[model samples]
Target: MTSTFTVLPVPLDHLFSPGDDINSIVIEALSTTRWPDESTGISDGDIIVVTSKVVAKAEGRVVEAASRESVIDQQAERIVAVKHTPRGVTKIVQTSHGLVLAAAGVDASNTEQGTVVLLPVDSDASARQLRDHVIDRTGVAVGVIITDTMGRPWRLGVTDVAIGSSGVHVLDDYTGRHDDFGNTLEMTVVAIADEIASAVDLATGKL
Candidate 1:
């Protein structure tokens, strides 16, 4: 038998605001959005991947600063590298959450003008809360992943990566496993969370 999975984008029409309940909003949206089989609800083992921007917005992480640089400085724990491009100087730094991202994940898109959005205070905690809420409301065990888009160190384009996750195995360890040819794998740990996030991003696009 062939194993298969699906990626469904939940259409949320309501704008996220400060102090909004994102879990409830997501549940309501799922209730309204029809599945491929015409089902109206989530199922067990379903993985819900969410964008970090919405989570940050709902958590009141938006701020108006003198400049994006200032916000980046405040959020960055340590500077990793810097690059000067035609656009401007791009600083890749490790944030307080230990995420090494360009501009410290200080996003200035899809928000009010002159305001930027920061990453959630604790993304893993946020994912756990959402996962718990889903189980509580729908009685379905689901995995939740909060994602953000970032450019790879040597890659040209950006891709979504998991910054937070819950109710899911974040990594698949094949270190001690043997291959079909009987070659023992020494160091093989796949980041399944980030893979899921990247797949979801392909469907959701850059939001």
Candidate 2:
């Protein structure tokens, strides 16, 4: 199957207030933006990812009257481990999904003072909803992926990760496949989604 991506450009820059809800803001952004049903000539199995900021906005996950520390406070229940570096990122424990970066998976860039944006309430659900909407709208059997910016170990800057996906498999295992030399491929599940996410970030200049 072929793979592709569609990145929406909204240029959102703001802070989420505590009173803000993450779900509503995301829906609102989607309503305002003209995300067409067309795929710009992409074939099936293409994954379309909207930046986490837009999703967070639509969900109304804005916080106010507090900084990064406060953002972490709300996520106290989800924190699994903490790391120390020039910048901070905690290895978080997730309930509905796997162990991710943080409670809200939030960061301190392109946000206003005393506020930060949290992740979508349910990334997979959000992706499914969007995918269904698109199918209903355009009859396209395309996949959808919701991406968020995240920091990586030994990496200098931030990049996108697949928080949501539909009709696409992030991992491809070839453990049983033998190499040209007849050596079995061992533990060969590639993070294709993440690789595409990084490529999209570069193309869209999401820095």
Candidate 3:
């Protein structure tokens, strides 16, 4: 059978507050949004890419808004690299999650006037909980990915990448696959989670 892929961006109508149940909010959003058809809601094999900001908020991973430098310092384990931009000095640091990212994944945007958001304490666990609760509520087997924005080492702009994933095959291994020329393929593993996260980022924007 032939196969096709689709990524649907679910928009949240309500401003999420700290300690909200993410699963309920997501299910509610799905309930309200008009899908392509009645049967076209979430289903098995569907991948839900949720921004980590919302997940963090729901988990109460936030603090009183502080200066960007201070927030970065608090979250970063060590500075990996730094660049002086016109706005200020930009630092790429290794976060507790072992991710080398800008500002150590501390975000001030889309947050309350006096608060900032942090990465979920354990993104993988967060993803698992979301996946389990969502499946329980809807009876639809779906994958969940918690994503965060990061700047590529050599890229100018930023893109969303998965920090936590659940019920999803994060990698596609094609090490033994054959090529059209009948040659054996090796060392070919695709990072499916990051790709999905990046694709959804285009729709979500930095806001």
Cα misplacement distance, residue 84 of candidate 3 (Å): 3.3
lDDT of 2 by residue, 103-190 (tens): 4476556566666777777877877877777666556586777888766667787778887777778777888998889999888888
Q: What's the TM-score of every candidate structure? A: 0.95, 0.71, 0.89
Residues forming the 10-long window of minimal summed lDDT in candidate 3? 31-40
Cα displacement (angstroms), candidate 3, residue 126, comes to 0.7
In candidate 1, what are the lDDT values of residues 1-207, reduced to their tens digit?
246877888878777889998988998887875677777678889998999999999999999855788889988899999999999989999998989999999988988988889999999999999999999998999899999999996778999999999998999998989989999999999999999999999888875
Query: Which run of 10 residues does model 2 get worst, by summed lDDT?
Result: 22-31
Order candidates by lDDT, high to low.
1, 3, 2
True lDDT of residue 58, candidate 1? 99
> For all the candidates, what are their Cα RMSDs to the real structure?
1.5, 5.3, 2.1
Query: Which portions of model 2 show Cα errors greater than 4 Å?
Result: 1-42, 65-68, 76-96, 102-104
- Highest TM-score: which candidate? 1
> If candidate 1 were superposed on the true structure by all CA atoms, what would the RMSD be?
1.5
The CA lDDT of each predicted structure is 0.90, 0.64, 0.84
| 147 Cα displacement, candidate 1 (Å) | 0.2
Q: Which candidate do you rate higher for TM-score, 1 or 2?
A: 1
What lDDT would candidate 1 get against the real structure? 0.90
